[model samples]
Target chain A: MTDRLSSQFAFLDEIDRLKAIERATPIGDNSRPENSAEHSWHIAMYALVLADHAGPEVDISRVIKMLLLHDIVEIDAGDMPIHMAHDAEAHAAKEAAAAERLFGLLPADQAAEFRAIWTEFEAAESADAVFAKSLDRVQPLLQNLAVGGGSWIDYNVTMDQIDTRVGVKVNRGAPRIWQFVRARVAPFFSASR
Target chain B: MTDRLSSQFAFLDEIDRLKAIERATPIGDNSRPENSAEHSWHIAMYALVLADHAGPEVDISRVIKMLLLHDIVEIDAGDMPIHMAHDAEAHAAKEAAAAERLFGLLPADQAAEFRAIWTEFEAAESADAVFAKSLDRVQPLLQNLAVGGGSWIDYNVTMDQIDTRVGVKVNRGAPRIWQFVRARVAPFFSASR
Candidate 1:
């Protein structure tokens, strides 16, 4: 029991590093780039508050859990922006390894549960995972929109890139939210061009 | 429908301020004070990773939701530390008002749900809320322990104060966890004196 508790504590202590893992999107006021931990919190709150817009099959509690656990991999692999260019296979391999190492710090059962949730989120296949993935994309879009094309401008992200990279997944799970986001996002692209 | 989405977006935008609301506790390495948003996320992760230790009646999903919403009131009322001197009645009134205004920014149903969870967490009456409240106290205690008495030393906290303020509640919801924490925390207090 003592060993189990210690493993859990060590895992928690290690994850504190997620707060220092900076992402590309800034906060609403754009004072600084938001960190992964807070982005996870905001999206969990997004799951809670905007759950009504999710697909009928979605389980919100599970979606919230996935969102909270999703970016923890960023603690080890670091934040990779959606618009940034990277070797997809290498980044995925690194994230998978990071998930194992970090989640492996927990007692066996918890380590498996967290790793499964993190994996499910990466797969984005289940209804809950799909909704969770949508939210993962939704948050950064909202941040970018709030800051008048935040990372989009930073990376010279185009409308086609936004549609292919962001729109398809969010629309798959939460079409209404995607619709709302599309309307808000159009002005930014038009003004940029 | 558009109006509802706007309200929800407004609420999300407002909560970006929470990332700016600093707490008394520092991160593990003591680089800087932790913000309320990341703290909420960390504790939500704590509730997830440590649910086995909670009382049998505790539904961890509810506990996670409660933990996530609990400190959002701080976005308005601001963080008031456990050891800080303040009027209990006045602070409660302030927090109540803050909850109403902040949660009120959501669509009506979401506002009501978020407000209820926040209030339940404040009441600390239900099994889930009790566990949620316990983890809330536990995280800061761990942070303080990690930093060689992080805020406890800064505020000149004594062992008795820790027992009365932190131990009792954690023990109530999770006696085993409290026992673990007690053992880990003893050396810090003993060394300080």
Candidate 2:
């Protein structure tokens, strides 16, 4: 029954309480810490700018919608870094709960629409989601590279770990980009090895 | 000169910082926070949902673009609430400085485009800018209503103040909605007074 002007909602204050939850920042110029909002915007841009890269069958606007709403759950569950030593399963549980609470902020209709998008992003079953996920992963890697290797250095990250973290995604969205990453990093690691 | 991807750029931790910025919630649900990223998304929806109400001559997509990029500067100067006891002149100074630092994040072409949008929104001269501003103002009132008189009660906000905050925006964007707000709130306030 409620809408954008429900007048009885209690979460207004709590909504203000939410903070940007992002992974730890590293030192460097090429690197920039992306906020959840910024991350969403960037992903949306990917849908716009990289539409050609997405499978021709995918609906880019849907992918954009997915990216923009994907992280709303971090409002409650908090942000976790891709390179964290945390348990993946536990993080998933927290995010799921957060999604329910955060998206519940909207009126029933809007909430349902947003919830569906977030859920689709999580499912990653669709070609669009798959492609979006790749950009999500690849963007951070490039950011680290730009910043002269950020979290990668602090964690003593190796090429193998980077590949797993980023490779799987690129493979799904753009195998060519994945191949490019593989070709670039394997040599540096091989020489070190 | 430094550009979008800093070959030696500093602020590698910008991602987390931005996340923190985006997650920082405002006083209302419908109202866009001072964050540039969320502001973009919120405004897009406004353009769509209120398309019927928009001036016939306005480009909805252009309006959406203006909204999305309008607030990227809060990344540097931070958010200034509409009702906060702040100096309007000083805030303008702070924002100008922030715009330079924040929008400069994108590559040159993007930076120019974004800065122009931000400027246009601030100028409020264009139809898209006017409509975007209207949405910005209306969203908070809707949020306060939705959250059960949220910031309205918390701030002991007055009818005169609320009217002034949203009056022009509503009139400009959707005269009908403005009329609806006046019809709903005017009598209630007079009686309460």
Candidate 3:
């Protein structure tokens, strides 16, 4: 029992570093880039509030779990901005290694459970995984759109890039949110042209 | 449908303000005080990680919902430090009102669901609520302990006060954690004396 508790506490201690793992998305105010922990929380809140908009067949509980645990690997891999990370192959390799070391801090059963969940989310095949992916993409997009496209402007992220990279997955899971995003966010970048 | 989506989005916009509502407890590094959103996120992660330590009868999912929404009211009421919020009556009134206004931003069903979850957490009567309350108190306590008693030293918080305010609830829900806290945390303060 003591050994089990130690493993759990060790994992908890490791994730405290997540608050320092900054992401590309700014807060709604554009004061600073949101940390991965805050991003996970925000999108989990989104899962709760906006689950109704997801496919009717999706399980909201599983979606919430996936969102909560999806980014734990980022603590080890460091965050890669979607627009900035050039080599997709290297990114995948780094994250896979990170997942092994970070989740490995947990007791055996939990490490396996979390690893499985992370892999499932990465696959994005199941309905819950699809909706979870949608929430993940929509959150940064919302933050970007809310702050007049902070990352979008900074990274020179074009709408077509966002539509292709983020919107496509969002559309697959929650078409209504994608519709809302296109209607509201498209105009800001379009007007700049 | 648009109007419903509008209400949901409006609520999301309001909660973005929570990132600015700082709490008394610092992050594990003692660098800066954690914000309500981060606090909520951390504790929800705790629920997932520590649920096995909770009483066998407690429902982990319900506890997670409580921890997530319990502090959403803080976005409106402002965080009253556990050791500092003296006028409990006024604090309760303010938080109740805040709960109604903030959660009310959701569509009727979601609003009611959130309100009920928040109320249940406040009541702390059920097994799930008791366990949720334990996780809530433990996270900050762990934060303070991890950073060599950051808030405890800053606020001049006493062992008796912690035992009364936080330890009591923590004991009811997760005695093993409370045992861990007492053994580890008491030494830090005692050494200073």
Best by TM-score: 1
Off by over 4 Å in 2: A1-4, A7-18, A25-34, A175-193, B1-63, B72-129, B138-166, B174-193
In model 1 chain A, the worst 10-residue window by lDDT is A184-193
Per-residue lDDT of A98 in model 2: 84
Local error of candidate 2 at residue A4 (angstroms) = 4.4
List, residue by residue over A73-128, the lDDT tens digit for candidate 2. Answer: 77777777777789888988998888777767656666677777777788888888
Candidate 2 has a TM-score of 0.63
What tens-digit string does per-residue lDDT give for candidate 3 at B36-120?
Answer: 8888888888889888899889888778778877888887789988877588899899999999999999999999999999999
List model 1 lDDT by residue over B1-193, tens digit each.
8899999999988998899999999998899999999999999999988988887888999999888888988877889999989899999999999988999999888888888888888888889888888899999988988887889988899889889999999888989999998999888888877
Rate residue B25 of model 2 by lDDT: 30
lDDT of 2 by residue, B9-123 (tens): 2222242243334322353444433345544555455564455567888887667667655665566667666766878888889889877776565556655766788898899
Each candidate structure's TM-score, on Cα atoms with residue i matched to residue i, is: 0.98, 0.63, 0.97
* Alpha carbon lDDT at A54, candidate 3: 81
Question: For candidate 3, what is the TM-score?
Answer: 0.97
For each model, chain A TM-score?
0.97, 0.82, 0.96
Assess chain B of each prediction and give its TM-score: 0.97, 0.78, 0.95
Model 2 whole-model lDDT (C-alpha atoms): 0.62
| Shift in Å, residue B43, candidate 3 | 0.7
Docking class for model 2 is incorrect
- Tell how far residue B94 is off in model 1, in angstroms: 1.3
- The top-ranked prediction according to DockQ is 1
